[model samples]
Target: MLDFAIFAVTFVIILVGAVLYLYPSSRRASGVPGLYPTDEKDGNLQDIVNKGSLHEFLVGLHQEFGSVASFWFGGRPVVSLGSVNHLQQHINPNHTTDSFETMLKSLLGYQSGMGGGANESVMRKKLYESAISNSLKNNFSTILQVVEELVGKWSSFPEAQHIPLCSHMLGLALKTVTQLGLGERFRDDAKVISFRKNHDAIWSEVGKGYMDGSLEKSSSRKAHYETALSEMESMLLSVAKERKAQRKQSVFVDALLQSSLTERQIMEDCMVFTLAGCVITANLCIWAVHFLSTSEEAQDNLYQELQDVLGSDPVSLDKIPHLRYCQQVLNETVRTAKLTPVAARLQEVEGKVDQHVIPKETLVIYALGVVLQDADTWSAPYRFDPARFEEDSARKSFCLLGFSGNQTCPELRFAYTVATVLVSTLVRRLKLHQLQGQVAEVRSELVSSPKEETWITVSRRS
Candidate 1:
């Protein structure tokens, strides 16, 4: 889901490509009410930068123009839908693939047809689906083991010690994703640490690089990025080779092996799942724990749920789904954090929303952040209330916002499970509390990370 932000910063160029020549940026074209380009070439991109992020810009744009609004994204008139009704109309019934994955394809410059035809696409689709499905289902124990190990590590920390919440969560996510997706090689801490080091290097560069055009301006920074990327890809390639030779069909890599996807496609797919998966899982845990630390009532409720459903037993896959409140806590965290704030879809055919007529190929922004906080949809939209999810209407609203429902992305579903298991296990043994006067601001990057590391203290429960 980081694709929703990382590639989005560059989408105007990557997605539209040469379309700027076909349609002039000056023309508003449709009845959609919105802003026109302030500059001849850059469109409203400067205004977006001035407003902070695309998410923030959309917030103001929708406030001024209502649910459906248009803005210039680098010489292209892009329309954004900020209400549930608008999104319902935009939802494509037949396009079943994840919307963010399509953005990823644009980022990787991968053409679905270029690798193979319709039959091959179908096979690869099955492989992708089964890879995530069977990997999580078949390897649930492995995921639980990793979660237990992290709980074990935390249990060892001195009582009332300040824990680096962000760092520990990120490390845990990387380890879980690697071992489950590739193989047991990641069971060794050194390999996982190495991957983490290189990933940190690459992640910092890629997120900031595209945002400010620094990746291209600084040669050394770009070199380090490529080097880190190469190392990460090489590690995955080694796993792919080993899995292929063994003819293993157990996890994600093996599932991809069953398909005729080129080596490049396999690597890219692996990269997407691992990289995006890690950030999402890490941030989800960080925010969930942070939010819990600040709310004693919610913490008590969650702990009670764990006690009722799990008791003193270790977390098992069978019981994970039974932790209803646990899922709500995470859903509220995602809604509050706006982890993936914005996502866009290409208008394959001319579409209409209200009185607006969308031209073919026009980029339709989801403006998810705006809708996530819209007063009309949510009660006290800014409050961190997991209990809101207790209502069926609230759950339906979340699905309409594209965070859940039948269309939930595999990465998120995976993150939710891993996070629930880990958080459940920890809360069962220890009490979590916020540091006095300790507050952290949201970065709203790749996937809503804390602007700086957020620290918390833990003590054994009485």
Candidate 2:
């Protein structure tokens, strides 16, 4: 009740203030083609709400307005670049990881040390990126262990039993990310379950709440969301403290502990990785499994690649380069699912894209979904043909979008490694089959996921 009362009051205040501030006098800020506020106070926020998510809204927006478009975000003017040509003018993938970092922070309400000098922000980003990299490198065997355990469980299931693909993938991702990104405490199954409970509680509401302000309307939901956020933060606090006290630490933890960052900085970063890492890793695996299940040829090619490269041995770090077909399958899954549909960066200085001048501090969006499935770019763009990725042209398209190669953000790179290990193991042992009469439809939000409980049955290979 207290949570409700407080949020009710806060929501009312913001609502009233927004109405006055965004009164009918406000005008569209760009010459670029796009939407004006349907109601002056709400801008295109209502349109986004009506269309489901920003990604969906962009799909329609770009369709009507072409690749370069504008929309008001609340009262502020925002620009979206929806084509590869437009994005090439605006992106430095290396620097734009911060945009994703900011987006994650917004969705999770991770606002510790948010006010800092440029150098401090730079230092923290380097540390966070390094944390994921060092952890993956230093603890790869642990990743293998998690994959082996998951495969073992699947092997034990009765023949023809329908597996809850999303549910299991979420657990597998949670277990892998929590154990590797944090520590061995997650090796305890109970710890992983507890963490996942809180994670789901927060993620479920916040994914919509950040955009729609729905969480504040119900106090019960607010209370639960806040409670889970508190618990997750406390868990990270405990982990950080334990790392601090240890005289002997793994290279991963030691790098973080020795940093000049304040405790809150470390905690905020841990929150970013924990939440973003889990969702990305889980969804990537889910889509890859589902897509491969739907296409026997793709699965066969991936399985054959596994056999040829990793014949009679588990996937090794050195062997990843040789697993060309596996990489193609994953890349195609990313494009087909349009995983991570939208990303935005705040302009640091005034800039020009094509013919328009973007004012400093404007929110500039990368309309990744529009281009990922663009008909002009790919032949039969919606088709799930992994063979397309074999072409240097398709590969270049992926790189330009920052969805392939080293240009992808660190968390995605991390997810790719984890997915490769798990998928490689599963494909080697089981033939994944999609359930009959199930059409693929996605819920495109912060990331793309199956709109319903996606079920697949796997048969053990003789």
Candidate 3:
């Protein structure tokens, strides 16, 4: 009994030692000069290590560390840059060091395979670009259809009943993106609905897993990850097979089919594309509605703009360009409520930004949430002022990282169109009301969204 007790004590000691060894340690010894010097008050390494909220913690760190601060996240050296010029230098398409597909693989749960190879990466970029160009040509009618359907359904819902705006937007986004990408509506079909539910569940679970690092350690997390991958592959395989049988060409699906990609690669690309569209589009729609509901003046101004431009006619693709205030409102929403609050990339090769030396293979995160809201860049950063985008004085301060220009998110054009249609259609027909005394709360995971089950009351505008 004494011998067993001794062994147990030794085992506990060893376990504690192992944990201490693994715990993230401060590594500020490098003393790398940053674009903005780190504030001594904000340099509490223990606070950073203890804070589990990635986005909030990062924002706080940036507040102290300046735009190009260096810090450690779980033994990984992360160089954070928030300056627009720095982002332009590093994240552009011509920048050979940035590996978008590799970053995407980490997010999408795909095994990083040969870094998508340089030639293949370029090809993928071209394919994405072509897909966007083609989607612009083909997706207008499909977007209008989705918007019309959403408006029709909301109008039919019993008046003054608080509608789950977030979920509804999510469902509508799923249907809209699927129709555009796969040429099929998956919202009502039982099999498709099940797939979407599973897909969303997987993302939610896996996002938790990634943030906590439980995905690597927990068996249940592994199972969830595998289940998500398997279910996604199964769904996509069925879709691909059907497309093959029908011999129909879809811009998204066909791009995958024709590529020399393995089955897993095709599945990863399809799932990421679909999921990205759904989350961003849905969140954008919800925020737009939320803003319009709270600001009667903004809504009235938008209604007038729509009336003059659309004038009881269905919002055509051609007229979208003329809806200037509508565009400004969406831009303001993006600025205030950034959908993708943070973006990360790894430095493949050593690079220098002024006096700061970023080593090769360093992880760099551009914290857009902080940067966009920074007082240095925006006046009245907290206010939801769409007019800021109207004046040249205010417009110069606006650096929306959504597309980020050179390394533009490929789907921005498509997402903008869908959001425009939805907003224009709804405001043209309905009077959106904020549930009395119910405030909308923002939720952040892999992407930022309104709290699930956000309720809004909608009535037809008389």
Candidate 4:
């Protein structure tokens, strides 16, 4: 209740201030090609989402309207950039635009006053980069320890034990992030459990707001959301207080605490990091296992590469790049799995991409899932062939947009380190096999995940 009250007050003040300052500039219209189709007779756009064919729908739109097209969302023009050229033009590396902030604010209903400005965003990004960089280099000890713990658990499972990959991976990711990001070790702590509950509660409500204020429309949901946010905030606040008191720390939260951001702002970042870190890393690991388990050739090649690089020695950050096949396998997993299907940027100025004129304030989106599988760029697009990435030239293609491209998020970069360590450690000892009866299918969420419970059996390789 207190959190909601504080938020409500801030929301009102920011809303009024925005109306006075930003409304005039935000009223510009973009003249783009395609609009979200609406039924002429009923004056309602077709609810294509109900059919669970959003990916097919997006492909159809691109095919029909060309690379750059527009859709109407709540009377605002959202331009979808479908091709690599369009993506490069719109999400240029030189631009200082922060797409992640735009995404969090627009999609998550984050108020502008809560860590929204360019400078604040930069501070947060710098802090994240610094923490991850330091941890990646200096904290390999912690990472290996966590991975060994995970391996022990897997090894203890009985032979042919059907392990639910998603749940297990989630736990591993949670533990890893808690240790690396928070500068604290967590092993089923009550506070950790509370944090997970809140983290899930908040994510479950994504994309549900903004429909006539639907987040607050249901009192029960509003209460639940408020409680979750409050609990998460409280947990982080306590951590922050303790970390601040003891000035000796080297974690992401410590970096954040030293920054100019307030405690609430730091909490917001911790929450975002949890979402970004845990889900993406988990999906990457799960998908890597999924593809490798099914493809004997890829598994053999990856094992050979690991052996060639490590040679019975343990995996470390220093050796990740030398294991080229492992990188290829992971890259192929990202390309085939399409964990994050789209990335969006809000156009701050009128822009021209190819022949399309994108107006100011338009939400420019990159359709990664469609482009990654584009037949023009990828041969045998649907096949899980890690060998496709064997040639550096093939990997250079812009289709792998999320992590490898110019638009790579820091979270994904951090995920690579975590995923590399886990994959290297696990595959070195255990031979993974997919359960024969269950056919894995891709399901779309905020991130992509397997539709069914992905069960894999671990057998001793040596």
259-286: candidate 1 lDDT, tens digit per residue: 7777878887887788778888899999
Q: Write the residue-wise lDDT of candidate 3 on 156-214 in tens digits.
A: 98886878878788777777777767766453567558768767766565434433356
Superposed by TM-score, candidate 2 places the C-alpha of residue 105 at a distance from the truth, in angstroms, of: 2.6
Q: Show where candidate 1 strays beyond 4 Å.
A: 1-29, 93-97, 109-122, 207-212
Cα distance off (Å), candidate 4, residue 255? 1.3
Instruction: State in Å the error of residue 367, model 2.
Output: 0.8
How far residue 216's Cα lies from its native spot in candidate 1, in Å, is 1.9
TM-scores, all candidates, are: 0.91, 0.90, 0.83, 0.87
Task: Count the clashes in each prediction.
Answer: 0, 0, 0, 0
Worst 10 residues of 2 by lDDT: 1-10
In candidate 1, clashing pairs total 0
Better of 2 and 4 by TM-score: 2
RMSD of 4: 6.3
Question: How far in Å is the alpha carbon of 85 misplaced in model 3?
Answer: 5.5
Best by TM-score: 1
Each model's lDDT comes to: 0.76, 0.76, 0.63, 0.67
Query: In model 2, how many backbone clashes occur?
Result: 0
Candidate 1 global TM-score: 0.91
Per-residue accuracy of model 2 over 385-443 as CA lDDT, tens digit each: 99998788888878877776555777788889999998899999998888899886998
